[model samples]
Target: MEAAGEPIPLSALQHAVYCLRQAALIHLERLWAENVFTAEGAVLHAVADKGGGRHARGVRRVMSLPLASRRLNLAGVADVVEFPRVGGQETPFPIEYKRGKPKLHRADEVQLCAQGLCLEEMTGAPVPQGALFYAATKRRVVVPFDADLRALTEAAAADLARVLASGETPPPTPLKARCRACSLHDLCRPEAVARPARAWRDRMVAAEVGPR
Candidate 1:
């Protein structure tokens, strides 16, 4: 359970980035509905969460690595972290598993960056980069933890903390592409609520402007 002032879940940061209302629904209201997309994601995670370690090609691979960052107050489990020899020393490299390919949104990248943040805190070593393995594409994309990404991750943590602390569900502003794919679409009913909300906004604007 998470309170307004408690440590935030790393997943919540991703959710917040994707959609604030979605984050509020999941973390604040404890609502969830599994669709095919979510189901596929769950299956992909299931395979990675076996929780063990092994060495491969001189690289030490760890699965289901528990990660926490006191600095950012974020916590979550990494799917896989490979400590490969870099410059004659092992460096932590996190790899996240996703169900789909990369999209326009930066949610997935932000999620992976958050994991790297946690690893740096725990291991007291610099986590310069990570990777995202997309099941749909069957490809891995390397992500550099650059200034922009680190800043975005920090901002997401703050936004998520505020949403959870407020404990209020945000109104729906549905875009078809995202809403249709969301697991909570049935419960969110964006189409049902968005029109009326927009109408109210129009009315309020008219009231403010008088006649213009």
Candidate 2:
């Protein structure tokens, strides 16, 4: 596990994209678990890894490519990075594998964009686009590194840093859907912290002073 305030892992950004508290729980507290969802996701990535460094048509496929951006203080592995021969030039395109279908949130996209940033920083070239391969759909969805996505990625990284600096796990999100399927559901106990509680003084007064 990485120490708080150190170079934040790329996974932290993904967690932050889901929920800040969840990110803190995993990154700051070193808590994790595996559920069916996570297990399937791992399987999908393993398949991607086996296809390492192969050339097909004008594309060179590299699997499990390590990436880092010192400027952003983030590090992670890209499931697949494709270098396409376009007009006699090679362009880096990152592809992320997911166990589920695409969601309304940008958690997965932010992760891809961050990979592009790392590639850019290392190669001094702009990564304009990437793709996400969803296990449920088994299709690639193209994502452009426009201004909006770049900003979102940067913000997620910065927020992760803030959460690490504070050294406190954020409270659970109000939306229960986010908690129901998490592997850390039992450990996080979102419902436990959400419940209202009587003050300690009030309990003491009731016990020792008066019932009414």
Global lDDT of each candidate: 0.90, 0.86
What's the lDDT for residue 29 in model 2?
88
Q: Give a tens-digit lDDT track for model 1, residues 1-212.
A: 38645788888888888888899888888889999999999999997889999999989999999999988989889999999988898899999999989989999999999999999889888999999999989999999999999999999998887767776788887888988899998888888888899999999999999997
Most lDDT-accurate candidate = 1
- The most accurate candidate by TM-score is 1
> lDDT for model 2, on a 0 to 1 scale?
0.86
Candidate 2: segments with Cα more than 4 A from true spot: 196-212
RMSD of 2: 4.9
Give the worst 10-residue stretch by lDDT in candidate 1: 1-10
Q: Model 1: which residue pairs collide?
A: none
What TM-scores do the predictions have?
0.94, 0.88
Q: Candidate 1, residue 183: CA error in Å?
A: 0.8
